[model samples]
Target: MNTAAYFAQIYREPDPFQYRQRWYEARKRALTLACLPRQRYRNAWELGCSNGVLSAALAERCDALLGTDLSAAALADAASSTAAFANVRFEQAHHPQDWPTGQFDLIVVSEVGYYLSAPDLSEMATRLRTSLADDGLLLACHWVHPFAEALSSAAEVHEALAGGLVEAFTYRDADLVMQGWGVSPTSVAACEGLR
Candidate 1:
């Protein structure tokens, strides 16, 4: 489906699969957040933040958090849900080519990577590598189940990111898979220290 049509459907009816409503999704989000290397972060950027449910959770751990989506309708819902958090902002944005200008201490790629083609995913990997701060952390989570229109699989996205980064750890089960990357050795050491 075209991006416009695809997003239009989502705008019309938000998919609970990506939201924090279901037990499966809630569990995945919790696991994603728990794997972070730090207790708190100065800034975080979450891409494809559908309805901001996880964004709300992330705001508690970040001094400043920006959640972006290609669909304005999604941002509307996000803005409403995150209104109480002064440190959180929502915007309509596309990835890789339109990545935000500043560095991010933490970046979340929840269910966003599969929307890109393989080459675009590679470009995104490069952009992510450049955008992360020296001691920053990157968390990636995606559903392992296949959709016919998806350009790549969850494993492929993780592989692309792994190729560009040093993998800190990973979590996987029947429903979803997550990968963590630390930008520097210090962050890796810190993650190891917790074990």
Candidate 2:
């Protein structure tokens, strides 16, 4: 089945994903949030924000946050859940092709990379390169287990971003893996006192 269909099926009845009750997901989200380079961000974008649980957490640190998902049902749930946060917005968007314009100080890819084909993920990374602002941060959190529709493994997706960017942080557990990257120039400077 296609990525959209597969996700639609999950959203139709997401108990199997167990995003809320599972300790694995909670731990991964915590790890993802901890690895961020900055304590606060001006603008943040989270693609494939499955029900907006993490998006709500991201809203606390971001001045403006946009969370997108392909499933309408998911978006509805997200909107209702995050209604109190005026800075948080939810939309229905697909990746690589339907990406929103403008630069973001923080970009998050959580549990979404495996849906795309290798080439598509590469293109998404390229787009991320251009869309990300200087000193911006990118966080990728993915499940470590195998799935039938996944085009690439979590390691491969993390590896694709290595050559072009600098790895800032990483957290791995039995259920999830998280990686953080900062673009060149400011990358090393941020490590030193230059920035």
lDDT comparing candidate 1 with the true structure: 0.84
Error of 1 at 146 (Å): 1.2
- Count of residue pairs whose backbone atoms collide, per candidate: 0, 0
Model 2, span 1-195: residue lDDT tens:
487887788788854477789887787778778777677899999988888888888999999999989988888888876888999988798888898878998999987878878898898888888888877988888888997878888888877655587777878878778888878433445665677
Put down candidate 1 lDDT per residue, 1-195, tens digits, no spaces: 566468767688765355655777778778877788788999899989878889999999999999989888888889888989999998788776677879999999999898889998999988888888888888899889999878889999988887757787889888788988866553535566754
User: Model 1 TM-score?
Assistant: 0.92
Off by over 4 Å in 2: 14-16, 184-195
Q: What are the lDDT figures for the candidates, one per model?
A: 0.84, 0.83
The Cα RMSD in angstroms, rounded to one decimal, for candidate 2 relative to the true structure is 2.7
Worst 10 residues of 2 by lDDT: 184-193
Candidate 1, which segments miss by more than 4 Å at Cα?
Answer: 14-20, 186-195
| Cα error, candidate 1, residue 9 (Å) | 1.3
Best by TM-score: 1
